[model samples]
Target chain A: MDLGALFGNFNNFLDFTVGGLVIGAIYALVALGYTMVYGVLQLINFAHSEVFMYGTFAVAWTFVLLHGTGDASWSLGRAVPILLVALVAAMLMSAAIALLVERFAYRPLINKNAPKLIALISAIGASFALAEAMGLRDRFAKWFGLDDNLANYVAPNKARDVYSNPVSIQPHGLFHIGGYSVTDVDLVVVVAALVMMFALDIFVRRTKFGRGIRAVAQDPEAAALMGVNSTRVVQVTFLVGGLMAGAAATLYMMKIGSTRQNAGFLLGVKAFTAAVMGGIGNLRGALLGGLLLGVMENWGSAVFGSEWKDVVAFVLLVLILLVRPSGLLGEALGKARA
Target chain B: MLLEVDGLCVNYGHIEAIRDISFGVEEGTVTSLIGANGAGKSTTLKTISGLRKVRAGTITFDGKDITHARPFERVLMGISQSPEGRGCFPGMTVLENLDMGAFVRKDRKSAAYRSDLDRVFDLFPRLKERERQAAGSMSGGEQQMLAIGRALMAKPRLLLLDEPSMGLAPKLIQQIFTIVTEINQQGTTVLLVEQNAAQALKRSDNAHILETGEIVRSGTGHELAGDDSVKAAYLGGDL
Candidate 1:
């Protein structure tokens, strides 16, 4: 470990911190999907990672459709419209996939009164099936005789990393904090994520339908007695979570500039960790957990090595589970502030 | 009859909780099932509220068969339940909990809704005092009041209350029966399940005594209250 180097280089630490916050914002968005599904169903939607993965692909695909696979830079004015469209595309795609997963993978079991463990296994299976389906898009497209026409979307090297057509909104330096530049990309990601999180928190706390979600999460039978349609509530929860993940995907593509079929796997896991760290079912807890996890992971990489960044996240997760299983905020969605 | 249960049989995995129990709740009258804990009073209420599947029975509400209706459908059809154990969402305020009771009402923002809220407050001023307090943090008596008040928010034509006097002091039990009577007089048909025979029987217009899983006796509340056998078995041989 290079503690001496980490302490000696204050500028490097600030840069790492900003970078961590940027990625952390994305994690918070994805984690809401995980936490919300858990809140109502009490099942860890293992396939949720694939939902984010699909959304990232949607973002990439939307960019390709709007602005061919060119590396040419565009002015901010021209890029803004394309970015907005891509955001909507990503949201619709992810929300559709999330609803599909609920319908095909989980609903049947729920209808049959299947055990929760069985549902979890089904989620893991669905996750694999979704990832593999994306990975095998080339072969699937060839079977349908559309490979030649859709080569840009699914062709040579379909399984490998796919880059979005570059919309080079260069990271203009907004300010300097301790000799480290705070770029516009960091500001945009953090602010956009915060806006989405606050909107969701308000919806869950204040709105009537939002109250229905909380009511079902707390007591399904009681909610039914009070005339809350729990099935509709479940669908809405999945939809809301998917929308947040889609927004996160857009921000991620804006910053990272690329995506792959399986990119959601690692990031999804990281977001789940963030959810657990914050308190799995608490909305605001996700925000706090994601930001904290990002900063800590980045700091750990600096002290140790960059390769050990993932290790830092898992280690923190284990520690949190052992010490505070309920998480930093320690409240389920049902018990959160009214 | 506002509600009728004919030949109702409910089972929990082959163990009959309620066996061929048939009763009718008259409109605007309080009907009570007074029995021991394991005599299936709760199961019968649960079946009527659509929480439990009937093995063999027909439950007709306002002359419409509701044997297979979902719980929420029953609520929309003007049936509501203040379930056993006062199932209040602990994370929400008393007001939110009450709001949940009116979940199916489309006129929540109207003056009708406001008057309903006022009625609940008038019925249990204690709930109004702790309107913003979390339902879970309240005393048991207060939660029970909230439960009944919440059921009222549905403006139900027929109300099902399971064990409303289950866990309370003697004084509170008397107070609850009084409110139950009051709510019945206000044009709501009440179906009550209780272990407190004296209080329940005194307030009920019609009463059934359940034993094991069947109704053993049915009479006017005054007749059952005056019966020697009922007094020996349920009322400690005296009122």
Candidate 2:
């Protein structure tokens, strides 16, 4: 561990913190899906990683379709529309996949009253299936007799190869604070995530639909007696979580500049860790956990080298679980709101 | 009849919880199913409310066949239940819990709904006092009140209450029975299941004695309350 590298440079520390927050926003968005689904079903949607993965492809495909890729100088005005389109495309794609997963993979097993472990295994299977589908898109295109140009543009030769955003929005420094720079990308990611989080919080706290969700989470039987359709609530929960993950996918591509076939796998694991760290069923906890995990991992890398960054995050998770099994915010979604 | 159940059969795997049970609740009446533990009282209410599947039965509520209806659909068609053990959302505020009860109503913002809410508060003023309190933190009796209060918020035509007096003090039990009578008088028909036979019989207009998944006897509340066999087995020999 290099002590000087860890704390000697104040400016470098600030940069890492800022970068961590940007990444944290993405993790928080993906984490919301895991936490919300767990809140209602008490089953982890391991396939949620695929939901995020699909969003990344959705955005990339949308850009390619719009003819917005490859060495194109994108003005702020022109980029705004393309960015909005990509965001919507990603969100829609991810949400669609999430609903499909709930409908096909989990719902049947749930309806059959299968054990929870069975549902978990089914989720893992669905995750792998989705990941492989994306990884073998070129083969799929070939089987479908897709046009060569379209196939090359959408699937590419190597599915696992890094896919870059065609219309790159040049990063402009927004502000300088204490010799640390804040870029437009970071501001967008953080601010957008916070706004979405606030919107979700309000939706859950103040809206009737949200009340139904919390009620189902607390007691499904009682909620049904109160006229809540538990099945519909579960579906809505998956949809909302997927939409957030989609938005996160867009922001992630903007900040990190590339995505791969297995891009969502590591990020999804980190987001799952964040959800558990913040309390699996609690909404606000996911946000807090994601940011905290991101910042801590960056700080760890600064001190112990980049190789130890993931190690530090996992160790922190283990330590936190040992201290507070329910995470920092605790595990009550309904209780927390109340 | 506001609600009718004919030959309702429910099973927990091969073991039957309820079998060949038949009952009816007249409009604006309080009916009680008095039975000992494992006599299928809770299972009867659960089946009616659609929480449990009916292996063989026909449930007609408001003249509509509802045996196969979904739980939420039953609630929308004017059946609401305060399930056994005061199944309140422990994490929610009293107000939020009540709001969930009104989930089926489109007129929740209307004055009618407001008055309905006020009527509940009027019935149980303790709920009004602790509207913002987390329901799980409240006392058992208070939780029972919240549970009943939550069911009332749905403005149901038929209300099914299972063991509202369970774990409650004698005075609180008496108070709950009084509220049940009041709620019945307010035009919602009730089907109550209780272990406290004496109180349930006294308050109910009609009563049934269930023993081992079957209705062994049924009569007007007064008639059953006065039966010798009922008195010996359920009413502690004196009531």
Candidate 3:
């Protein structure tokens, strides 16, 4: 790790900065979902990352099928349509998964007046069950006709470099400007994340459903008095959050070019850290906290090398809590409790 | 009758709060339910507002049965309540609270909505000065005004008020009761629950005295105000 070599290498810095932006974007997407749900319910849906995980596999299968149709000619033009279809499919899948989880797992716990800690444990259990169900390679591959040996061969747990070719569909080479070399994938992730964030922010702050969500978040009983169905609003919150997580999953697969079974677990944790780091219930806080964390974590890794990447999240979380626990953009503990 | 509650019973887990209380509020009249603390006055109002669990009987408002309707549904069907403890959405502004109140109404962005808001402001001028202030940041009286204004925004056919004068100064109590009479005079039927039996009876057209979860006495406001036992028990012992 020559100091001069690493500094002179614009590619690594690009991977750090640009990669951080894209990854931070996904984290922000996932974190927004977490923040919105937490804002409304004050309950963490730990299964959200598993929802992301399943979505990655769902999109991957779509891409593989598209690739098998002799459209192995992957280009920026082709990636766009494939990405759109895959995202919609993945969104529907994740939304259904979220609805079921809420209907059976969370709703029952809420009805039982179960402690918050128990709800968290149930969420973790659900996450594990979903992961296992998804990792059964042949079960999913049978649909793609990679049956028998080929089906078992394309295992999800394998390393990203398992392919001999290790395909690198670079988006027409990285463009350089000043100290940054912004890749096509980086632009895609960053733009998608921002678009999604803006859409959600508008939806929560502007739309009728958004007002209902805010009212429900503020006071469920009062929200109900206004003829706002608090329960339905809550369900829609989960549904929207799940949809974002699914889209994040698809963009993540495109950015990384590969994924693993446990991909979303660490990302989910970090994204959740982003949500908490920003203020659990505030929307803009989640996005700011995520991007800030992404940039800082990369900068920290640049200073201390790779081993310190994981430490960055914890250190920043503690420092933020010590200085401003409500997050950078969050106010006092007003609606955090509600 | 505008609002009829028959055999209404409410329980908290195991303990019963109200038992078979029956009442009818005629259209366009101010009806008040006054009782001592823990006598189930608020519970009756909560049941009518669809906020509490009703273990028995039916509630009909404007000839439509709405016993199992959701709280929001009740609001949409022209039934709204200013809840106890001044349950305003604390994080929101006065205007936002009013917006939430008008959640079921279509064309909320129309000029008519703004006019209704102006009416609330005219009724409670204190609210106009603090339109942007958070509801929780206001004083008790201001919060109460916002609560009533919020209920008015719903354009409810029946307005249920739970202890509107609780924790208010005597001067503020008089002001609120005066406004309550005015609100009723404007064609909004009010069913108010109050611990200030004398003031409530003085303000309402019809009155009911609740004791131990049952209506112990019912009459015109002046009759209850003149009754000796009612005065001895509730009006500060013959004040």
Candidate 4:
């Protein structure tokens, strides 16, 4: 709509492009959770959003515990250890929550031979319960009589936005593409995400557990005939998805600096959108969909006011569904073994 | 006996697939269950391999009661099946599919693994040719061979094969039966379910004729093939 402004400000467009890619990397990581779970279970785990949310809190709390609520940035030497600690914390917490959901919420219904729609309803319920439990942490802490000791983690903003300790490492200049200076933060985000993605791809393609997942995905009965325990495969699927969401959460907190109890809701929806856009059960498709969505959303925001960013993203999703419902890759996890 | 099914009954949501079926598969023998469609031949094999629930009676394999065992447990207990319709993992390469067959074995790096792999390749050289190709993209005959070869990779004491010749050409079917006979000769007991009555009867040392989920007749391969009634009903009035 505003082509003149977009063309006139080419430098701003470049900045937006870089920024989009950085955020897109996070979306891709989170989208892996959706795609992998769908690959094995053929169910959209609405509760996966909360898995990411818990990870974001883990990252924030790890920072709060390591460095007090101060605006002091850590030097590169000091930050590396703390960042690694936070990453592990976030991944572990998220994976635990994901496994819990699988065990308590989904497994019961699955064992009962319940319909997919019923499992979906259960996921929605689990999602709400998880978000609400985080939102009501202050009162829950009081019930445990540890509210005063854990005030930093539970207080002041139980139901509101919680800010992470501003221990952000200042970004140095990295390289420039097309006259746009890319920062170290951008490189880290993109590189870390890509490494995780490739690691997951290799694990799925080469490992024995990965083979079990693909077997179950292709044919559960046949997989059983091959001696693959479908239950174990399902657990591994959830755990892997959760780990990726946690990784995304850490990157998101690094870039955005704050989170809410309900933070994962919108982002989870967007990641699911990315998964669908890429190909619901395909690994590479999630990465492609996330990056494409981010760049297009940014461009649309610039052209038609920032308010229309979500509109542009959703409209793109609708258009993609209309044109190719199977997604850009048009292959499920079973067929995308390569 | 390598595998025994005594008074086994299986149901598919109230429709009995197999009823009161009792049979014993002697070790190192090719035992065949010949029948028309819906006669429960496949169902009987599926129940024995632990894929289907038995509503009544017990399945004892190598003298261990496996009636309530899980499918994976059955495999671990040295019983493997190439299920009906040749249930190959379509997304995986032929080598990967074969590897999956040996999933229960922790000795993948041992010489036994190599020998099993070599044996499968020796049995069906076509699978070795398509080692890196996806199983789903292969022809039906090739898929059948891969399915049987995959089952063999498990190194089972007994192999349960369901309709290995279902969709193959006549020549391919003959080749598959020859391999089946060869596999039996190489010290693996076989329980084969087939609609190819003539071919099954020719190869089976002991054969049973199933009708409406029950065993209507049991005899040696020569006895049933020589019987005039069986020749008219199942052998199309000749051979």
lDDT of 4 by residue, A1-338 (tens): 89655567777778888888888889999999999999888999999999999999999889889887677775445777777898999999999999999999999998778999999999999999999899888888888998888888886445565656568776767788766898877788899999999999999988888888988888888888888888999999999999999999888877776788899999999999999999999999999999988888888888898999999999999999899999998657868657
On residues B1-239, what C-alpha lDDT tens digit does candidate 4 reach at each position? 88888999999998988889999999999999999999999999888877788899999988989999988888888989999999998889999999999988999989989999998998889988999999989998899999999999988889999999999999989989999999999999999999899999999999999999999999988899899989988999777
For candidate 3, what is the TM-score? 0.91
Report DockQ per prediction, comma-separated.
0.83, 0.84, 0.59, 0.75
lDDT of 1 by residue, B163-239 (tens): 89878888888788888888888899999898889888998999999998999999989999999999999999879
lDDT of 3 by residue, A121-197 (tens): 99899988877666565566667766554542355434232221122245654677556667677778889889988
Superposition error at A274 for model 1 (Å)? 0.4
- Give candidate 3's root-mean-square deviation (CA, Å): 3.5
Candidate ranking (TM-score, best to worst): 2, 1, 4, 3
Among the candidates, what TM-score does chain A have in each? Answer: 0.96, 0.96, 0.86, 0.96
Residue pairs clashing, model 2: none
> Which candidate number would show the highest TM-score if scored against the true structure?
2
Model 2 misplacement above 4 A: A73-78, A147-149
CA lDDT for candidate 1: 0.89
Residue runs of model 4 more than 4 Å from their true location after superposition: A74-77, A166-169, B110-112
Assess the local accuracy of residue A213 in candidate 3 as a C-alpha lDDT between 0 and 100.
Answer: 90
Question: Candidate 1 clash total?
Answer: 0
Residue A297 displacement (Å), model 3: 2.4
